[model samples]
Target: MSETNKDDRAALLAEAAGPATELPPGWLEVVSMDMDAQGVARKSDGKVVFIDGALPTEWVSANTHRKKNNWEAASLMAIHRESAQRVRPGCPHFGLHSGACGGCKMQHLHVGAQVAVKQRVLEDNLWHLGKVKAETILRPIEGPAWGYRYRARLSVRYVPKKGEVLVGFHERKSRYIADMQTCKILPPHVDAMLMPLRALIGGLQARDTCPQIELACGDTVTALVLRHLEPLSEGDLARLRAFAAEHGVQWWLQPKGPDTVHLLDADGAEQLAYGLPDFGITMPFKPTDFTQVNSHINRVLVTRALRLLDAGKAERVIDWFCGLGNFTLPIATQAREVLGIEGSEALVARSRENYEKNQAQRPVQQALAATSFVARNLFEMTPEMLVADGVADKWLVDPPREGAFALSKALADLHQARLGAEGAPPLPAGAAHWVPPQRIVYVSCNPATLARDAGLLVHQAGYRCVAAGVVNMFPHTAHVESMAVFERA
Candidate 1:
């Protein structure tokens, strides 16, 4: 090794082995990191310490703020040694300081390093929680590090004390909104509107009643949804119209739940939509619908997911928890038939509408395969329901944070029944001809729940984890989005 490299390594070792009396009282060497982006260390007695704003391989002094029997939560006080991956955060509102925005966590770490940590977290969750290891680790999917957030819900509060409206994310661990003027994570156009939005909200009579502003950006249009507890006066409505006209953005108002969201001026307002050009499909959705926050990554994700699924032209495919037919329609373009199932009838209807819209747009010579949508409470799935749905050649399971626990468990129960295990549920009548999908591609936003369902699939359902990898859907954040492919053994 070079003399300079040797000296640096020796310095780090010396710092780590320094006497307890020489360093700060709570000095500890961060050994690893957790899913929440906290640095993990242990006291001499083996008591675990979770320190915020610290990274693995860094030695920092921490102040314990919350303690339990087994672990203590602390904040970084001083760093005696720094990690090479540490970087200056681009956003002024991002930090551990008081009143900082809670929109992101890993901004201080290098973007590549952030993705690596998330990849490690996915691997650890799969092995430690599910005890299932993938046969191959796919390359991580990456996109732009900034200006990638096509969706965001900004909190608005009229802080009477400051005599101004506060608009942005909530303060870290605080209900009060952060005092941010601009955000780097949002699309550049949306980021430019942050201050203007505050001014616009501040000028309204319902400013105090208005609680949130949600942004959804498409290829050519940006839609903002304002959540107001009370009705807007005529003057306020006029002001909103003027602002929308001036900003080149459409305005949607929500007086109640997501179902009540509608455009302020529907006439001549462009429809909100995103396109997956790979499949020549454009999906129209309301701002309140559960669309992926990162549109660019979502497109790449869909492409990768469909590639991994490898549905044959003559094969049938099933999309569980399909919202707006994002995957179902794409699969329909390639497969013989596609069945989309979701819990909400409203979403199912929308999915069907999207399927028809795409079909109408397609050339007469190039028609999509048969596609259908159904609403069923996936959380209450059973072997009987599985038999009724019939078997598909492949499954695309993209569930919410809760994951497809019930669906996975049902499959496991069916396998047990096939084995004639004691106390196992008897096969539903006419299920003697039932068969499970040959392959399943699971897209997950929560790694823990994915691990749990993966355990059920691998250990109980007679399937093997073929390949898995992390998707950098939300960069500079602790959120780990992943996809795994499972094949029947």
Candidate 2:
């Protein structure tokens, strides 16, 4: 080879490799963790780098996968100094590798540290977004670390090229299904069914039609809702029945939307219900209804919320965004009158039925307090509507990820009106008689939204953020479920 030819080869190699400085030089110190469980570090140029599979206080190098002017997203390449809070991930399918499961993000971090990180996230969100701080930081509520997921939505895909069916969560940041044979977060029995489920679906005539399976486990019964686009044949139905019998699971089929969900065989199936033993309350729900994924944490959460709300026998309480009367009925056991409000009429109707069902089982001495269910779009609340609903002594607010913005805003409006603040909205017709609830216990799923609503309550509504804390509802995942207590000043 000539000298000129060698020089050309060297140039070609350099071009193929792109930039020699693709990876960040030296070790980066992870100072904190973002909401998604990614480690936050600063590069030499002062740009932020979000590194996956890295923990706080750890020195590491990362391989950049995405880059921008202000930040770079990278994966942990090497750990020069590992943090004591790091631990081996429990799940075989959890990793930064290709086709890893997206179900969990904090499996590598110690479970105790995971809860601490979530608490910091809540605190950061409150201070940064709401510009409010809680007077007291409540103790973090923790529960069973593993086998706690009582509900899951497993995606099903038939791969003709592989001649197999995949049943699991999506791959990390990809729509492709993860090749998961077992899951650590799921109940052992449910986890054991993964391989069998794949085999069952792969063998079915309607394998190509079935797209998803939603699992919901009650105290006495486990239900699986199968979503199928095409009609199943008699053979496929029999197979489902046989599988249900073998696994002691109930099968619910959904031909289209959630409304179309029905039991495959209702004659001998156990009623799906979870019991709040402390309150002696049993909640019966359909497979499609919105129920907590972690039953244990939910029961504890309800108990803690009621304890914090402290609705007395003489006081009237309202449960906002109440679905299935989870809190209203329990509150009715103590309060003079309790109202359960929800946006969906169907949910309100079901909540009424649940109230009736619970009443039938109660003894004469243990009778429930007066309770009523009403359908209302809480997101469109106004001060006038608040006055019309009458005054409640206490409230239990458990909104979804959107949080209770309008309700908070309504209270803020009423406060400003009473103060005669400039530019405040006009008071409603019955504003004089409308006394705001003395206390509110808010259950939130999103910290950012919670902080926004908290701002309205603390700064504008003349309420003190008494206490707040994190609820480890979904362990191993980056989800942050929390609760906050506010009291009128």
Give the distance in Å from residue 363's predicted Cα in candidate 2 to where it truly belongs: 0.5
List the candidates' TM-scores in order: 0.94, 0.94
- Where model 2 places Cα greater than 4 Å from the true spot, the runs are 1-25
Candidate 2, 1-489: lDDT as tens digits: 233432332333334332333235667888778777888777655566778999998889889987765567789999988999999899999999999999999999999999999999899789867998999999989999999999999999999999999999999989999999999999999999999999999999999999999999999899999999999999999999999989999999999999999999988678999999889999999988889999999999999999999999999999999999888888988889998899999999999999999999999888889899889999999999898889999999999999999999999999999999999988989798789999999999999899999999999999999999999999999999999999999
Worst 10 residues of 2 by lDDT: 13-22
Tell me how far candidate 2 lies from the true structure as C-alpha RMSD in angstroms: 8.4
* Span of 10 residues, lowest total lDDT, candidate 1: 1-10
lDDT of 1 by residue, 1-489 (tens): 233433333333334443323345668888767777888777765566778999988989999997765567799999999999999999999999989999999998999999889988898778767999999999999999999999998999999889899999998878889999999999998899899888999999999999999999988889999999999999999999998888899999999999899999888888899999999999999888889999989999999999999998999999999988989989998899999999999899999889888899899877999999999999999888998998799999999999999999999999999999889988898789989999999999988789899999999999999999999999998999999999999
Cα lDDT for residue 440, model 1?
98
Task: Give lDDT: candidate 2, residue 442.
Answer: 94
Candidate 1 C-alpha error for residue 129, in Å: 1.4
